[model samples]
Target: MTQPNTQIPDFQSIMLPMLNLLESGEVFTLNQVVTKLAEHFHLSKEDLKIKVPSGQMGLFRNRVGWTRSYLKKAGLIHYPERAKYQITPFGKDYLKGKPKDLRIKHLKKMPDYIEWTKTFNQDTNNKQEAEITKEIESQTPEEVLASTVDQLNKQLATDLLDKLKENSFGYFENFVIELLQKMGYGEFREDAAERTGQTGDNGIDGIISQDRLGLENVYIQAKRFRDGHVGSPDIRNFIGSLALQGVNKGVFLTTSRFSESAIKTASDSKQQKIILIDGKQLANLAIEYNLGVQVDKTIAIKKIDLDYFEE
Candidate 1:
């Protein structure tokens, strides 16, 4: 009978030395480990990409942080101060009689190392299992779409709440404008002071085309509110301004929120269609368009060529 294949040591094996060095009570920073580990292992800085120390200046900060976190969780290391880490007593004991088989699976049996493998694996498995169950339950296209939209709305509301904490109202307004533009209302423009009427002199903040041409328009009123829901009277005043402009549509945007009555009054009007965008909806739109943000990196994976396998 054939024996099981042995597992090989990888980046984690290389990190063990750095951990050992820290256990010796020598004061060293993440930068010091990056350089020293590279030299001791006879590997170039590029080779250390998979094992650089956490939060250090490099492209591998994420990987380094993961490794550090795992080591700490296993009781091999502890943080002495913010961003400063040191090896534990358990790590020192392991270093004295280090195991010859340095595979990660074998490392779990070390006296100092707690078995986080089972716990971490179970947590990940549970999340994936829940997602699978959800997918199995959502058998129809409409169900899937509805679920996705609901998720989008919840995410938007949560993000808006987070932004409220930051108190960046101007950024929030610009975020809303970008969202509407992305929804194919590209003909929209900020209203001039002269065009703004009572409600307040500059009440209507923007104007959007009902169609491609400028003939039909939808007036917009944006308020950077922090407290209290917009009342029915606010909606009445907005509709009055829309009527003055001879427009059938109006959009009322607020950062705080709108009362149920305000939403009903806006939609209840038989002659006009007034759109109400509260803080929750605004966040959802921002996320959909990816406004004010850009992805910094992308990764692509490819399969090995199979033609050589037949040779």
Candidate 2:
């Protein structure tokens, strides 16, 4: 069956209606919000069923997630649990005005919102520069394919981080193990890798044998630090521990970014080979390797038939 090309309203357009849904100060799960907003916008069943390019979830759900994310960042809403939020006191106050201009510009007034927007814009700029190449008409086939591919990958990466944070430490350790395995470290899959976080081996999370016989090893440290940046102290401690174990290779993975000093520390360690994987890089790797991702669909763009003109 052919999918419809219908469009749902952008996040900015849904912002006001969404805030109004929670304006009464009642808590709602994401499903409730998505359903109510869909009704308000009068989206058809088919429209609500439109899957994102990843085919993981409906596209509308993805947009609504962003709507909640942006609002949550601006301090207008608070998450009581995963995918559930209660309107904030500030949210009620702002809704009292029945805001018509709840655009991103207005959201930027909040410092948190500014930071969130910066991260999102940076991702977009990165993809745009690499994939799009040059501006073309929206009707252009190449432009459409490249643009959608870029957007889908960005969404996938963001969602991966979101889900990873909600998981347990054991889950995260296994996730990192799986990621490395998918990255071609699975040749010695039998006993090559195991979680050591449970044993608390000098802050090392896991170790992957570089060879099946365990001749060489790569120490793994996975930190699911959600908020704070990993600094030089963390890197130095990991490296010092590696030296104590007489290991030369280590991989440090974090769901947060590493500070410049931390990055520099790894670079300056000539005795040990260290690789730092940030949340963004980790997600991108997962996407590239299909670790927690799948191919949604492939698009082919055909050009004019020059043979017809020659004839």
Candidate 3:
């Protein structure tokens, strides 16, 4: 069989066709519309499998879903029962106009649509609302939300690293130990850890175990530097320190990045295993393990339970 076209229509482009499909006044489920719309667009198997950035839903289905929402908000179509939709008199009149395209701009001219938008815009300023609407027009809502969260996490990581740099060396050492423990190193055995507490103290800062029984130990060298790269000489010196202690494994944590030579030196070491955790990585770890950050807020998104309405 010949493959259908692979290009999925944008949400805006899907609006008119979708409204026309519903204007038959037959109540249809979302899955039914998704199937019909895919056929209408001649979307291929590859197109049907295409997912949004979050991989939560297919690209075509997501656009079609949002188109349904837009039509519903504009009072052109609505859910008569959960997960089922049908067109209204307004929708039939809308089709009679034979508009070139049904889009957010056309919906904005609708009083019901404007009022529905106000519910979401109550807390946002005019500029923010406009920006949000612009993004909604170009991208799926899930894509927009994911992009926002990624941007926030990056900024949070930068801020978190900056705070780490401002803290004292002792505090930084304690933080790294706590992070490692949280990650299952030393198995949270408080008795199996120690701090060197002095500068140039054989180039070692702390030590912890790799397992609960303390069968093996990992040496740590925590450097809280604000503005310089950890160099190869520093790594070699730490290696020497580990050799003095007769340890074969070490982790070097720094609030600044490591040089290429330093990384290579660690990788090339045959007798010892050295792990380097740079500032960005350190902050990300802290975030991942909830070491230095707290949950500020939680937002819950709700959707209809189709099974609840099923016979």
Candidate 4:
């Protein structure tokens, strides 16, 4: 009996097999590609089910995603649709050499791959040296990719906050109203949000209808601060404003972070539920809800057809 291979293949090790699997130019889904690679590597059920460090998904599945991401970066694969991918002519030609394995070193030989590397790390202007590339090669593709995404999002958030500071208080109010709508507030209705960031509103900027029938209301206290923190006094005042209005829930959003005391004040409130959204949280929400963002590009991962073996 052949013992199941206990070792899980890294993203680079999975690259060659991934390309070969897609070489037929057939549109394959990511799941299909994962299964083919698992079978090709003779991974046991246990091996296939291993979890990544985050444990949000199976490690093998993450590796499969990274494998596809790398191939897509190298121009070996292209997504024909949202969830479908196929190999390109260049990929097919590259496979003619029958390279036993694909590695970062080998990828650097390709102009598209090199360009893709630069594109992947957009903020980094310097060309990646051998050491940096090798270090990246050491980690699983998902790890590198996730870190890259986080960095990009952080930079974007900083830029977004700067822009927010430049806008008028009225613009900030409208932005929040639209943002809440995108986040499924008020059932995503255009009229779900009402801007009341006017004077004499008792620190309340706006109000959001929790339901289409308007049975409940979520008060919004939008603060557009540049560098100052939203301190405990601000939170207590908002909590007081909620009390005066007979409202129980409020969102105190600021383009700045909350002090420890402020966070504690919100948490320690027994009768009121105050949700604190800081600058970073606000920026990420904007990105997630696609307020001012647009889809840059999409990559599709592919897997094998299981029914082919059922018969």
Candidate 5:
């Protein structure tokens, strides 16, 4: 109830108090337990208001939810019915010892816990072991899953950029045109885009229709740099090219970053709406729109179907 700026307790820290609440062996719904734990820890209003990165659930609630899952996996608790939980005989016995903290290390000692974790990749070759350890200790299950996916995507983006730089400038220009079309900029019209393959075509590398009828158009400038930033002079020339073509909207796509002056130049341009997409942003878009990347696999994270057991 207090309004203090304090860090929310990690899921492991919540596990002990959570199991203590269930020691009475009485059934408590998940929400009921969450409310009790929030009070037990005296979580501040600001803390209660905090949410997971996805913003779909409250932070403390997510930690407590994962705490219950860990306890259940460790044979310390079990669902008595849909959405209701009670401490098992093992849970009560463990509480009798008056343990100070219930943690993953404690759970790992249990046979059921060991068996459950066997499904995970047990390879110890990870170079980020220290960081991974810290993450697992402090992050909720949802946070861990999200962090893993983000790291994977970042690595993929780097790889994609390297591969992109290996291609010819003409190929890169055509790729950007197709990328824009795939993103629904040109209404996916086959004849709506064309790459200007000659330097005589001014600074614009490509052009695409904004709509199917081609009433409006977008001028594209694709820069495939091996290294170094695209500077202001290049942006000014692209702007000048757009001005000459009487176009008010353009996309500047690059396989490298843009300098601060370049970004400022585009932002300060009064006559045109300019979007500057860099290497990382371009790679992320490719991944999102499934342009150059294919889905390697999909994971299904599920939960109890309370409605199925309601009867």
Candidate 6:
């Protein structure tokens, strides 16, 4: 006799029960649902982690959120409060008629599921309409593109930041220099304290040149910070150090984020043109340069040529 192949349940499988649990008057958090779903399906936490973080399970606090999102779009659910979700009369009817041998594949075959999918797509279209309206209200074409790129850069930066160790400040400094170099600022060197005369050697950490033979200099002050922002005082000291070195262009890089005052101070200073690169910017620079990361694939998008059709 041939053995039956065992099928492992996906995110939707776990979500249905969680939704059912919520409908049955059981209050549960995302963590609680994850635990219970894992046990019920005999799934390992690792397996659940992969699906939950990126799949439907991750869409809300629990499977309830995705269910509610779908059901609400289908007019089968309604939100009473910001976070609280409940099913509607249509949802109750759908659930009552739902098959006992419920599976993700089976759900697709159901009429209610098809209706929910259609409504879900329509809701998404409505959301896109709202976003387009908001964007049109507030920004110019150039500003919109710039804002979109900045958002993408920030998301990439956050991903890289998560991979870095908290105490690896030295590594962070090196990462920043490499990023700047990739950004067309070449002839760079680090920790050049040998040229500093007495008086405790000011606040500068390193000096980088844009060209050969140290002609055009860009001084840098690298701070390895864990918490608490870099203050205006720090910015002032960096400017003072730049003066001592007779350099007008300077970069202040830190692992920790900078305060608004620090940024304002740097911008407000008339003595020298100081550039402030905070933790977020530092990460973005790294991504732009592909310093510590590699590109897996490149996607190119193009539009149809209407001129060719006319010709």
Best by lDDT: 5
Model 3 C-alpha RMSD vs. true structure (Å) is: 19.8
Query: Which portions of model 3 miss their true places by more than 4 Å?
Result: 1-138
Candidate 4 worst ten-residue window by lDDT: 116-125
Model 2 over residues 138-157: C-alpha lDDT tens digits?
A: 34766677777787677678
**What TM-score would candidate 3 get against the native?**
0.55
lDDT of 3 by residue, 1-311 (tens): 22333477878899998999988899999999999988998887778887875566688887887788778768899778778989999989988988888777788877656544442232223354478768678987788778877656655675576577677999999999889888877765677777775866788888897777878998999999866579999999999999998989999998777888999999999999999998778877999999989887675768999999999
Please write out the lDDT profile of model 6 over residues 134-228, one tens digit for every residue: 87679986787677566555545544654453436556556666666678776344432222222475876655677666678777777766445
- Over 4 Å off, model 2: 1-9, 29-31, 38-66, 69-100, 108-140, 297-311
Q: Between candidates 5 and 6, name the one with more favorable lDDT.
A: 5
Native-vs-model 6 lDDT? 0.59
Cα deviation at 210, candidate 1, in Å, is 3.7
Clashes of 4: 10
Give the clashing pairs for model 4.
29-302, 29-303, 30-301, 30-302, 31-303, 32-303, 32-304, 33-302, 33-303, 33-304
For candidate 5, write residues 72-119 as lDDT tens digits.
Answer: 767799776767899999989899999987787778877655543432
lDDT of 1 by residue, 1-311 (tens): 22211221234665566676687766666667656665665654444444222223343343345456556645677666556678888777767876553334445554323223321121323344457668758678667657755654553454354455355655555555556767767534543111242345545666666565567666777767644568899889888877777778777887657777887898799777888877666655665677644544443436798997986
Position 173, candidate 3: lDDT: 91
Q: What lDDT is reached at residue 247 by model 3?
A: 89
Of the candidates shown, which would achieve the greatest TM-score relative to the real structure? Answer: 2
Ten contiguous residues with the weakest lDDT in model 5: 118-127
Greater lDDT among 3 and 4 belongs to: 3
